[model samples]
Every structure is written in structure tokens, then in C-alpha cells.
Target: MAAYHARSNSFPSRQHPLIPEFDEQLCRLRSSEAASSSSASLSGKLSGLQDLHDCVDKLLLLPLNQQALSNQKNEKWVDELLDGSLRLLDMCNTAKDALQQTKESTQELQSIIRRRRGGESSLSSELKKFLNSRKAVKKALHKAMESKCAFSLLNRDQEVVSMLREVQSITLSVFESMFFFISGPKSSSWSLVSKLMNSKTVSCEKVNESNEFASADAALNLLISHKMKNSDSTVEENAQKQLQELEMCIQDLEEGVESLYRRLIKIRVSLLNNLNH
Candidate 1:
């Protein structure tokens, strides 16, 4: 009986080392997974930051381009362009807000991970923070796009209209890309992926198509009006000279509009294909 008791006790003693060994192995595996997840989160955040930077760059350029074009146009166009400039500033502000929120979320996630004990999980807290940040980012992007599209539709300011159209198209494309990134197959979170992916593609395509048609129509109208004005001019030397200058300006505007249309079409096609695939 004493021998039996000794044997039974030795069995547990033999298994004692295995418990810590197994725990160590589990901890190592969990650590590896945590590290991978952390890396992925950081990479995603960096990509978002880069996108935000690009959007800001484009927003800055919008005002400068509008100013340059407005200088070459009528006073009405200048006022309109100035209004558009205010809208662009609004977009920049929204983007900055989103970026700020995302930065905070990232810092929070890092803090959670840092405070995690060995063999304890921090994934839930990290994912929660990330989702909150993503929601803010999406809201900001949506507001910016809506503001840009509205600005594009404003009448009597051809320069502002043109700049806003470009901004609208680019914003839609960027939003689609960001949506895909956040909801792609390899996304860390899977809860809302399907819903986001389903509706986004169709919405982007419609917006793009509508904007392209509007841009084309605006260009055509401008060209036709310029032609009509030139045709009604008297054959006086000064009138003829003015007509020629107007015609050249009209031609330049037409060419720029055509280029913009082609570029927008290309973007639309590419976005459609990407969405389909």
C-alpha cells in the first residue's frame, strides 16, 4: 500500500514539469498570434494614415487649382471658387478629425496590449477600439464626399464646378478602396464585412457615372455658348480679335474637359472591375 501511494505520487510529480511546459508553449503561441495581429493592425493604421495624407494633399491642391482657373475667368466664377474653397477646407477639417480619432484608437490599442499579462488576451479591447476608430473615419469620409458632390453641383462657377467634379470622383474611388481594405477577406474583424462590401460597389458606380455625365454636359454647354457668342459678333476688327481670343479660350476649356472625362471614365471602369473581381 505504501509502494502504491509512492507510485501514484510519483505520477503527479512526473506530470508537474509538463504543466509548466504546456503552459509555456501555449503562451508562446498566443504571443506569436498577438504579435501578428498587432503588426497587421499597425500596417492597416499606417495605410489609413497614408490615404488621409493623400486626401489632404488633394484638398490643398483643389483650392490652388481653383484659384488659378478663377483668375483666368469671370468675377462670378471667382466668388464660386471661393465658396468651393470653403468646402474644401471643411473636408480637410473632417479628415483631420477622423485622423485624430484613429490616432487615439491606435494608441489605446497599443496601451491595452502593453498592459496585457502573459497568457492573458487583449484582442477584444484592441478590436473594440479599432472598430470605434473605423466608424469615425467612415463618417468623416462620407461627409466629405457629400460636401464635394454638392459643391460640384453648384451653378455659375465653372472653375469650381470642374474642381469639385474631380474631387468627387477621386473621393468616391478612395472611399471604395478604403472600404475594401477594411472589409476584405483578410480583415481582422468579420462582423460587418459582408454588409459593407455588398452595397459599396453599386453606390460608387452610380456616383461615378452620374458625375461623369454632368461633367460632359457642362463642358458641352460651355462650348456651345461660347460658339454662339462668337458667331453673333460683328465683323469690326476689334470684335473679330476678341472673338478669336474667346474661341481659343473655349478650345482650351474643351480640351481640358475632354481629358477630364476620359480620365474619369478610366477610373470608373477600373473601379467596376475591381469591385466585380
Candidate 2:
């Protein structure tokens, strides 16, 4: 797919920029925290997202109700916008896959750092190289956002436009959640991330705050990031805590997906009512 680099200003009420960012998390621990269960939860959420995407795609493929149409039928907008929405959703899924890969990579990096005290340089170099290789994914993501944004302008006067807009918003929100756990592959981005994940001496608390963290959530993130930073705690203990956090995030995602599912259903029901009228 051509990398569709669409800026947010290309549409109105833009919530986030198309700038690329990568985020990922790694962990293991708590007696109550099951890596299996956390993994399952994440898997379930991704599946639910896939189901949602499929639902929209199927809806798009349905024949347009020409019988109920007026002379000014622009029903193709429905199909085209749904196509764009699906493209964006696919991009989000690819991002989810990338996040999953990062988790595995983090595990490998952690293990290597443990066995080879002097291997950090080589490992860091490899990680940065890996990130550069993923520039295509970054471009695809930005392009997907642009596609969704374009849907907003298409068929603006149509009733279905409102529903497509809602779907676009929900899809973007899901992407944001998935991206939270990932960090950039850039040297500086990975430098802090690796240290937080692997170095026992460095404290997330002591790290200088960046200007990007001006929101109230930034304070909470600092606390959570502090927890993620390595400490004197046993590896098992730390893993348990991290998994617990992961589980919480997954549960939140499940709720969001469920909510989205309900909303989508409502939109479908409303459309049916309109058609029958």
C-alpha cells in the first residue's frame, strides 16, 4: 500500500497528529498475575477489534439499498468510507502486531543484558536498526489516519456520515490505547526505555521530565513508569507486578471494545430504521 501521509489539519476537529510513535511493554510476576491470563486478555481484545473490523467491512460490502434511494443517491460514500475505515483498522491491527513483536524483543533484550554485562552497546545498536527498518509501518499508520480523516469530509451532508465519523473516532481511540505500551525505536527513545526496563541503578523517578508531559495523566505515568523501572525486587516479584498492570490495561481495553461494539450495533439499528422508513 502506498504510504498515505495525511496531516490532521487536512480535516476539522483533529484530535491527534499523524506523527509516528512506537510503544511497548515487557514484564513477568504477582501470585495473582498470570502471564497466560494477561496474554489471553490482550489476545481477546485484539480478536474483538478484528471482529469489529470484519463487521464494518461486511456492512460495507452489502449492496446499497437503491430501492429506497432518492435521485441524489450518494450511497457510494457509505461503501467508500467503510473501505477507508477498514484500511485504518487494518493499520491499527498491524500496529498491534508490532507491539506484540516489541514485547518479545524486550524479553530477549532483557535476557541478553542479564548474561552479558558489556553487550548493551551491540544490543542497543541492533534495536535501533530494527526500528529504522519499521519506517514503513510508521508511514502506513500516518496514511491510515489520513484516510479516516478524509472520510469525515466525504458525504458530509449524508446521515451515514455521522456514523462513519463515530467509527473513525472509535478506531483512532483504540489505536492510541495499543500504542501506549510501545516506545520509539529512536536511539534517545530506546535509550530511556531500555534503561527503565533493564538497568537497576537508574530510577524512573530521577529521570528528567520532558515538556511532552504537561497533562494530569503525566504525573500518573511517572508513578507507573517508576514501577516499571528495575529495582532491588526479585525478578519474579517484579514480573508479577508488571503483569498485574498489563492485566488492568487489558481489562480496560475489553471494556472499551465492548462499548464500541454496542455503539456500532446502535448505529446499525438506526440505519435499519431509516431504511425501513
Which candidate leads the pack in lDDT? 2
Task: Supply the global lDDT for candidate 1.
Answer: 0.36
**lDDT tens string, model 1, 167-263?**
4433344333333322223222222223322342212222222122122222222222322232322212222232233233323333433333344
The sequence of per-residue lDDT tens digits that candidate 2 reaches over residues 136-210 is 444554555455444445543443343345455545554543443332222434344444556555333433222
Where model 1 places Cα greater than 4 Å from the true spot, the runs are 1-73, 117-123, 151-277
Poorest 10 consecutive residues of model 1 by lDDT?
A: 1-10
What TM-score against the true fold does each predicted structure earn?
A: 0.33, 0.41
**Which pairs of residues have clashing backbones in candidate 1?**
none
lDDT, residue 154, candidate 2: 51
Model 2 weakest 10-residue run by lDDT: 20-29
